[model samples]
Target: MIYLQLFLSYLQIGAFSFGGGYAAMPLIQAQVVEKYHWLSMTEFSDLVTIAEMTPGPIAINSATFVGTQVAGLSGALIATLGCILPSCIIVTLLAKIYIQYRNVKIMQDILGTLRPVVVSMIAVAGLGILSSVFFLSGKFAPALSNFNIRGIIFFAGALLCLRKTKLSPILIMVGCGILELLYQTIF
Candidate 1:
């Protein structure tokens, strides 16, 4: 019964999570944290952090982690299969359809419109994480008093580096991880 629930839940998440993994954050959070209660918000946040730092899609990482937590190795396999199945089928169909309609103006227009929607969804997910981490203690609204100064600094610095330097993102991530480790150890 639990395995069936996990499969169905992740199948829904995988099928409907358009706009990639970042945009899928809200859906995954709702299903995993709110609907199922498999993990708390803090734990979800931590999972997201780990997922971001690791390779592969955030949704897959989340399914594997959550499934492992819920029912170990077999659970992980079932959840991962569930998470991948929808995308596999959908993409296969879309690829054939897209190839057939590659020259259509309406198809081009639809894809163009989808680009901005995907960006918006990703932005909203980013803001949600920011609010949850930085303003969570404030309860009602985000307050300067509850701001995470270190996080802001890291974000600013990373953005600047991304714009001004030729350094690869992996290098920047490693540097940030080292800085965060030192910060945590020292302060």
Candidate 2:
């Protein structure tokens, strides 16, 4: 029963996590903390930290971690499968039909149109947490006091690494983490 619940919960999370990562975080927090009482806000914060430090999508990481905590190995497997199922189905269908029509002008036009919209969504997700992380005075936009230099370094370095070099993301992350330690300790 617990494993079933975990499966369903993660299935919902996977199905609706449109923009990915931070976008899905608040929904997971509400589901786990408010609706189910599975974890406290602090625990969710810890989970967010751990997920951000890892390699995969935040929603999948959260599902796996929370599921395992709730019901051990079976929970982990079920939740992971549930989280992946929606994407699997969607991709399978799209591949089957989209491949045949992918070069069509209408389909090409639609996908081209979606590119900028997706970029805008990502920007919105990035800015959403700024208020929560930096500003405590109730202002909801970026200010000088709460600007995250570490985050800027991480983003810029990661972008350059991926675009200009052949370094893997894990190696880049590790290097950035070390730089962060040095920046804190020395500067």
Candidate 3:
């Protein structure tokens, strides 16, 4: 039953997550965090981080991680297969259709319309993570008392490094991890 649930849940994610890995974050959160209670919000945030650092798509990595957490190796296989099956099917069909309608104005317009929707999905995912990191309650609502100063400082520093220097994101992540470790040790 658990394996079936994992398969169906990821199947939904794979079918509906249209834009890319980042755009799929909200759908993944909806399934694993909000609906199933398989992972807490903090775990989801960490999953996002780990998924980003890994080589594959975030959605696939998330499916594997959550499956492993929930069941075991076989669960990981089922969840990953479910997550990718839609892409395999859809891309095959869409490729033929796209080749046929590549220059159609309606097709171009539809693609243009989807761009903003994808951007909004990515923004929501980013804000969700930021809220989880920077707020004590891990919610969108803000309270001065519940704000995390260290998280904000790290965020600012990371933003500054990204904008002002050519430092790679992996280096920034490592720097933040080291800084957090030092902060934990010192204070």
Candidate 4:
């Protein structure tokens, strides 16, 4: 039953997660956090952190972590396969279908409509990721904002480091950890 759930959960995520792996973030968060309650918000944030730093797609890493958390190693293996099964079927089906319908007007129209939604989903995922990192610091409803400027700087620094330098992402993560400790020490 758990294995079936693992398969179905990821199959849904995989089926609906458009715009590639990065765009899958919001879907994962929604299903895992909101729908299933399988992961807490903090855990989700940490999952994103580890996923970004680790060597796989966010969805796959999330499946592994959440699955493990839910049911240990066996769960992890099951969930990972669940997450990937749709892709295996999808690529195969698309490859076979595209040859016959590559220039079809309906296909073109469908893809056109999908492109914007996919793009928005990607942006929404980015915002969700940023919010998880910053929590409710930027919420505007009651106008409560308690952003840690130092941490924001560190986040920006990570981007700059990646763009301007060749420092590995792992090193940047370690550097950020060090910076967090130092920020606490100094402040």
CA-lDDT, candidates in order: 0.86, 0.75, 0.94, 0.81
Mind sharing the TM-score for model 4?
A: 0.82
**Model 4: CA > 4 A from native:** 136-145, 160-171, 184-187
Candidate number with greatest TM-score: 3
Q: Rank the candidates by TM-score, best first.
A: 3, 1, 4, 2
Positional deviation of residue 154's Cα in model 1 after best superposition, in angstroms:
2.2
Tens-place lDDT per residue, model 2, 52-131, is 88778888888888888888888888988888898788778889989899888999898788667656755654554443
Whole-model lDDT for model 3 versus the true structure? 0.94
Q: Tens digits of per-residue lDDT for model 1 on 1-187?
A: 8798788889998998888899888888888888989988778878888888889999999889988999898898899889999999999999999999999999999999989988988887787677666654513355677776777788788889999999998888889989999988998
Give the candidate number with the greatest lDDT: 3
Error of 4 at 41 (Å): 1.3
**Which scores higher on TM-score, 2 or 4?**
4
User: What stretches of model 2 exceed 4 Å from their correct place?
Assistant: 19-23, 120-124, 135-187
Q: What is the lDDT, from 0 to 100, of the residue 32 in candidate 2?
A: 83
Q: Report the C-alpha displacement of residue 56, candidate 3, in angstroms.
A: 0.9
Tens digit of per-residue lDDT, candidate 4, span 28-105: 888888888988876777888888888878888888988899889999998899888888999899989888899999
Model 1 spans with C-alpha error above 4 angstroms: 136-143
lDDT minimum window of 10 residues, candidate 2: 130-139
